[model samples]
Target: MSAKPLTAREAYQVLRDIALGVRTMRRLGEKPLTGVYSGMMSV
Candidate 1:
């Protein structure tokens, strides 16, 4: 399927969300050292 491109505001919001997610992970990816890490991950 084909769709039109997002408007400027829409694109900004989308990118903002992605950036926030990355920033959040970067800030919390390693710390505390008190959690079980099996073989899978979910959010």
Candidate 2:
């Protein structure tokens, strides 16, 4: 597997995007993904 290394700012932006996506999914009633995100965040 090939992984691209992101700069700190780039990584932060990616994380922010993911956070927004998860929040939106949660608001839209995506229970499975919302549970996954909540579980991961608690860790």
Q: Write down the lDDT of every candidate, Cα atoms only.
A: 0.53, 0.53
Q: What tens-digit string does per-residue lDDT give for candidate 2 at 1-43?
A: 5557788997677678778874332243334554534553210
Question: What shift in Å separates residue 7 of candidate 2 from its native position after superposition?
Answer: 0.2
Model 2 lDDT on a 0 to 1 scale: 0.53
Backbone clash pairs in model 1 (N, Cα, C under 3 Å; residues 3+ apart or in different chains), count: 0
Writing each residue's lDDT as its tens digit, candidate 1 over 17-42 gives: 76888523222234444446543332
- The CA lDDT at 18 in model 2 is 75
lDDT of 1 at 18: 68
TM-score quality measure for candidate 1: 0.46
